[model samples]
Target chain A: MSALLAVDGISKSFRGLKAASAVSFELDAGAILGLIGPNGAGKTTVFNMIAGVFPPDEGRVRMDGRDITGKRPDQICRAGIGRTFQIVKPFGGLTVRENVIVGALASCKTVADAEREADRVLDLLGLADKARQPAHALTLPDRKCLEVARALATRPKLLLLDEVMAGLRPTETDRMVAIFRQLNRESGLTILLIEHVMRAVMALAQRIVVLNTGEVIATGTPEEIAADQKVRDCYLGEEAA
Target chain B: MAMGRATRMLIGLMVALLLAPFIGNDYLVSVLILCLFNAYLAQAWNIMMGFAGQLSLGHALYVGLGAYAGGALFFHYGTPPWIGMIVGAAIAALVGGVIGFLGFRFGVKGVYFALLTIAFAEFTRILFDHFTWVGGSSGLYLPVVRADHDNLLLLRGRPAMFYYVILGLSAAVFLICHRILGSRLGYYWRAIREDQDAAQALGIDTFKAKMAAVMLSAALTAVGGVFYAFYTNTLYAESAFAMHRSIELILGAIIGGMGTLFGPILGAFLLTLLGELLTRLAENFGHGFEGVKQIGYGLILLVIIALRREGVWPRLAKRLGLDGEKAS
Candidate 1:
């Protein structure tokens, strides 16, 4: 099958420094692709480019064979991509359900329909009990779940999750990994995640791509990535040693 | 239960407002009218700043634009004030659109965006102060008709008529704001207000949403200005477009509660009542106490800000079992 999302030789540069250069990757439908890299590896930059935060300096981004490069974030989202921020951005004053309703409204015909959809998403994310609470009152793990719930409410074909497990506890991380597995298997939702938690990434992602300094160093199954010499020497080696 | 309380509170308020004119006191009626007028303007300002989180410290720009447009038409072409009001609102909306486009498109926001609004208002004030056609710094005066003969068509001088008109305007504006707060645009505005970058990531067109808010706010404020021109029977650039006017308009919104629907109205009534009382007290204390009213206002604002940063309305609403959501 054709790739659900294709990033072709994308490059982005800031004033005097290159944030990302010639970064390319493909995500197939129903696949969980883990993007692992050291700090400042330009992982977020690649996500931003694909999500239409800014136009890539060179190359193109295509979703399901249609070019979506340089489109506005809202347009890109409407065209079937939803994303979460590394730093959570819940509508602090709105209720947890209302925050999700905002995303659901993009597809729903009425507020009631949106609310219903939001409820389902919140329940699926195990946030139903906190549905009526203000988003600012949520715990870190709940906040992360809220972000995922909001993204899922948009009913996107592909979801880009940015560091959703960064501040989570081990149990919380495991729960999140299980959720991702269920989403991939049951809903067939394509996911591209940037994560620092190696164990969660290894457990959830069938395929892993390691990036170092804005370049891809390795791409293979999780087990293959564990044994790759360059990945070990550059990224995993520091953690292992 | 919360919805029932909110509904009851709204009904009670409407009944009180509707019966206010029958109290047979002209001074009281006039004061109430002015209170409602302030409420209307603050509500207009609230839509842009309160809902959309776009701080405009120069909201008087729209009001002044509206007054000049409407007042000038009436004074020159003999156009009716109703048509003038619509035309004035349209002009203000156009100006608002331009200002919003320039500000949002160029990425000006927060304090800088506020400064831009102030600069525009100040620039217009200076231009109007010099322009001779609309009477310049001396000011423009609507033809004073007999106060006893109530002319509803021309909105000629009559306290009762002005009171009822403003009451209607306030009600209409209240309904519009309530509708917006319950709609998709309201959700988008709240999202953008919380975090623009995150809102964009969620597929919200932050720029367009904010621009719509600016235009809507400006248009409504212009309508208030038209009423002010006809009701007060005079307009001057200094008083109409002054930075103090803008500050006065927003004080009600801030003091009542920034984002809540009823906050601005409550704040306006409370502040205006206190201001009137303070002014009367100063008069009783003789000449040197003229500034006491202003001092009182300043002190009240300071206390409100320090004591209850969320303002009086939200707490009051909660106490009355009417607060449905946390104030933004």
Candidate 2:
């Protein structure tokens, strides 16, 4: 079966620094993929390129067999790619529901329809209780969850999450893992996530891709990636040391 | 469901405004007309700054464009003011759209965007100052027809007529703004206001939404300009396109609680009333001071800003149990 998303040798450079270089991966339909890396390994830059914040300096991005390279972020969003920021970008003055509704409005026909979608997404993300609160009032974890809820509201074919579990406690991380697991299992939602939390990554991702110094260092199942000698030398060994 | 206190209060205020000309002398009625004019202009300005978060400090450009368009048409072609209003609106919208295109297309934002607007306004003012077909820097004058009968069609005659016209206009603008603030477009605008990158990531066309706001605001302000041209029977580039005039247009929206439905109207009334009251008090005290009213106005504005950063309308609404779940 063909992959749902194909990131073929994407590279990006800023000024004299290379952020990502010829990094490539494939996410199959209904599968969860983890993108793990050391700090400045360009995980978020890859997300930015795929989500169309800026075009990759080289290489193609295809979703559902359609070329989507170099499109505007809004166009990419409507083409069914939803993404979360490493730093949460909640519409602070809006209510939680309204923040999600903004995302839902991309696919929904009307505000009423968007509102219904927002309610559903908020309920799914366990933010239903705080739906009426201004987003600025939310705690950091809830704000991160709100970002996930908003992306989900777009009804994406591929969800790209960036560091949502960074500051979360282990229990909270487990809860997030469970939520993502449910989303993947029940709806067959495809996900590509960047995470520093190894527990959540191991618990959620079906396949793992490891990045180091702007290149894909390893790709395998969680066990294979953990056992890979090159990955250990470049990333896991540093973490252990 | 029962009607909210805010709605009831709004209805009462509307009724009072409708009856004001009948209860007052010409001077008082004219003052009320001035208040409503400010209210209308502020409401127009609010769409760009308050709703879309695009701060335009050159709103007088639209007003001046509208006034000149309408006044020039009437003076040279003998066109009725009603037709002139439409043409004026179109002209203002075109100019506003250009300004918006330049700013948004080039990604000029925040304070830079504000400077761009001011630059355009100042440029236009100078251009109009040199353009002699419209009477150059001297000014453009509309003939004061000595018609015994009041001509509503021509937008001329009595202070009371001007009062009702401005009052009807202010109310119409309020309803228009309220409607926009409740729609999907309004939600999109608010999202863009809160965060542009986030809004874009959510698939909102921030540039288009902001452009719509700028053009609509300019069109509405132009209509007010047509009204001003006919009501005052004159238009001067210096007075109409002045930097201070642009500043005056935004003051009400800023002080009344920007982004709130009733904020601009409330702020406009408060400002106009305070200014009038202070001027009257100075006259009564036999001081006849040139800048006392301005000093008092500035002091009050500082107090308002210092005390309520969010503006007076939100707190006032909360006190009256009129706060709704929606931001509006």
Candidate 3:
């Protein structure tokens, strides 16, 4: 089967600094890919390029064989790419349901339709009880769930999650991993996640891509990645030390 | 129940506004007209600043552009004020579109964007001060028709006529604002206001949404400008496009409640009435109270910011059980 998303030789720079350089990856439908890197390893930058936050200096991003490079973020979203920020971007003044509804409205023709879709997504995320509460009032885990629920409401074919488990406790992280597993297995949702939590990555990702200094250093299954020398020397080794 | 209560309050307010002119005192009617005019201008300014979260400290640019457009047409060509008003609004919208396009397309935002607006207003004020066609610095004046003549077509000088005209305008603007606050565009604007990047990530075209807000606000403010020109029979670049005029437009929205539909109207009424009362007191005191109104405004603003940061309307709405869940 063909890949659902193809990132081909994408590179980006800010001023004189190289953020991402010629990074490439491919994910088949329903596959979960874990992106692991050290701090400022350009993982989020890669996600930004894919999500159209900014155009790459050189490269192409393709979804379902259609070139989507350099489109506005909103256009890319409507073209079926949904993402959550590393720093959660909640509409602080709006209710949780309203935040999701803003996402749902991208696909819905009317507010009623959008609200219904938002409610369903909120229910799926176990956030229905907090639907009317303002987003700023949410706890961190709940805020993360709200972010996921908001992205999911757009019904994207491919989801880009940036640091979803960053601030969660171990139990909370495990619960989220279980939810991710269910979403991938049952709904056939394709996910590309950037995670610092190695256990969650190892448990959830079918394939892993390790990045260092804006370049892909390793790509393999979880066991193979754990055994890779370069990954250990560059990333896991530093983490352990 | 909340929706019903809000609707009832809105209806009651409309009825009260409709019946105000029947009080039959010229001074009171004139004050009421000024109150409605400020409310209309505040509503216009609110759409851009409150709803879209674009701070424009020089919105009088649109107002002055509009006043000049309408007044020039009427004075130069003998055209009716209604036609002039439409043309004036269009001119203001065009200018707004240009400013918005320049700012949004080039990525000017926040306080810098506000400075851009101020710069534009200041530039235009200087240009209008020297432009001979519109009477330059001396100011432009509409033909002074007697109050008894009551030329509805020309919008001639009559306190009652001006009162009803502005009252109608205030009500129409209120309905338009209500309709907009309930629509899809309103949601987009609110999202953009809260966070532009997140709004864009959620598939909202933030630039277009904000531009729409700016243009719509400019168009509406221009209409108010036309009303001001015709009712007062005078326009000067300094007074029409002044920074203080822009502040006056914004203060109503801020004091009543920013981002709420009724906030601007409530603020406008409260401020105008207070100004009138203070002026009356100053007259009675017979000296040294010349700047008391300005001092009073500053004090009121300080109090609002310190005590109730959300403004009066939201608290009032909550008390009356009319606070809807929607952000607006």
Candidate 4:
């Protein structure tokens, strides 16, 4: 399979502490790649660099054939990269519909087109029913759905989700997993999921990469990683199978 | 029910404002004119603060800069006030661009952002005071009587003329802000305001969007300042660029309703009337203290913020039956 995105020798050092040390990976097109890590393991930091929150202290991030490292976030977004924050930050004063419109308009030159696109994305996510409700009024799970809806509105070629299932119950996770799978099945989306819930990850990820202390400890199929020593070592002996 | 209620209130206000000029006395007309001007400035400020969430404290910087740029050309270069007005707005926009670039690039946040604006206003006041070419601290003055009382030239010297001009300008600003608040830029602004770090990660260039808002707001504010200078026929250094003027302008917006369309006008009218009435009341009661009204104004602000911080207009609009305007 052809890799759609490549992160080569990406390193980030904060003062004397190394947040990510020579991290490297590839995400193939039309595949679900699970990124697993313990807390403070540079999982989201790596996501931030790829999404252009900050330029890497070293190395390059490439999409298709273009070098996108150190570019402005908006430029990166327009070039078809979209991300969701670990902490959902919706426009608190705006309605749910308005929040999604922000993402839809990020690439649009005109207002009317953004609104139309935002409405379609909301309808697809089943958020059309609560479109007029203020974002502050939403419950946690729906707010997570809002984050996903907001990112999808941007129409990214690759979506980077950071712990979207962290606080969700099993039933909610199942519903969301179904929706995500449907999106991939119907639209050929490539998803990079950073989730702590192994059940969801094992069920969805075609391949899983386990990160420990900013370094990749293991990379293989879910079945292979479930049986691997390194994956077991990082998981503290809670084997998936 | 919502749209229908909004429509009726709009009709009622139209009839009230239309009748005031012809039937009302000069004092009331003057009050209305001032209210309208405050509404316009509040609208301009809202584009920056309410939408972009920049929290500027010295917006008088725009007002003062705009006043001088437009007034000076008319006073010296024999430029028509109409063209000079545009020039004033342009200069304000230029200054706004500089300020926005510096602040956004350097990552100014919250109270520090406010301090940066105040610093600029104070710096400008000092410069203008030293630069006697524009009349300095003695203040900029226009040619009195302007060759005749009935001069229909844009800069004609008459209260009635000034009133009409300010009214027209305020209406134009209202229409422009009305358009912007519904535009794509508007959504980006609120997004940035809500969370700048989050906005950037979602692929928003907070810098560009914020700079654009500031530039637009500055240009419009300068136009207002030009009228203020011409109408008053003077531009005192302290009064024109005072930090207090900026605070009062913000107060108008906040008290009226920070982000609502008509909040500023309501704020300006209420505050101006309060000041006028307090003066009349002091004189009538024979209890004369020059700064008492100022004290009262401060207390009122404190009380309003302590009580209804979101603003009086949001509440007023709800009571008057105007709900949030849904994007159509």
Candidate 2 differs from the real structure by a C-alpha RMSD in angstroms, to one decimal, of 1.6
lDDT of 4 by residue, B137-253 (tens): 888888777534856475776566667787788778877877788887777788888878767766787898999988998888888898887777788878899887887788788
TM-score for chain A in each prediction: 0.97, 0.96, 0.96, 0.95
Which interface RMSD values do the candidates have, in the order shown?
1.0, 0.7, 0.7, 1.4
Collision pairs in model 2: none
Error of 3 at A117 (Å): 1.1
TM-score of every prediction relative to native: 0.97, 0.97, 0.96, 0.96
Which candidate do you rate higher for DockQ, 1 or 3?
A: 3
Per residue, candidate 4 scores C-alpha lDDT tens digits across A84-115 of 87888888888998888888887666778888
Among all windows of ten consecutive residues in candidate 1 chain A, which has the lowest summed lDDT? A232-241
Q: Evaluated with lDDT, which candidate comes out highest?
A: 3
Superposed by TM-score, candidate 4 places the C-alpha of residue B59 at a distance from the truth, in angstroms, of 1.5
Residue A153 error, candidate 3, Å: 1.3
Give one digit per residue, the lDDT tens place, for model 3 in B1-328: 7777777777897787778778558788988998999999999999998889999998999989988988999999988878988998898889999999999999898899999999999999999999899999999988886678788899985788898899889888888988887678988998898888889998999988998999999999999998898988898998999988998889999999998888998999899999889999999999999988888889999999999988899998888777664644
DockQ of each: 0.80, 0.89, 0.82, 0.73
TM-score, cand. 3 vs. native? 0.96
Q: For candidate 4, what is the lDDT?
A: 0.83
Please say which candidate is ahead in DockQ: 1 or 2: 2
lDDT tens digits, residues B40-108, model 1?
Answer: 999999999899999999999999988888888889987778888899899999999999999999999
Calculate model 3's interface RMSD in Å. 0.7
- Residue B109, candidate 3: C-alpha displacement in angstroms: 1.6
- Candidate 3 lDDT tens digits, A56-159: 99999999999999999999999898999889989998889888999999989998899999999998889999999989999999999988999999998899
| DockQ (0 to 1) for model 3 | 0.82
Where does candidate 1 stray beyond 4 Å? A238-241, B325-328
The parts of candidate 2 lying over 4 Å away from their true place are A238-241, B1-3, B285-288, B325-327
Instruction: Give me the displacement of residue A122 in model 1, in angstroms.
Output: 0.9
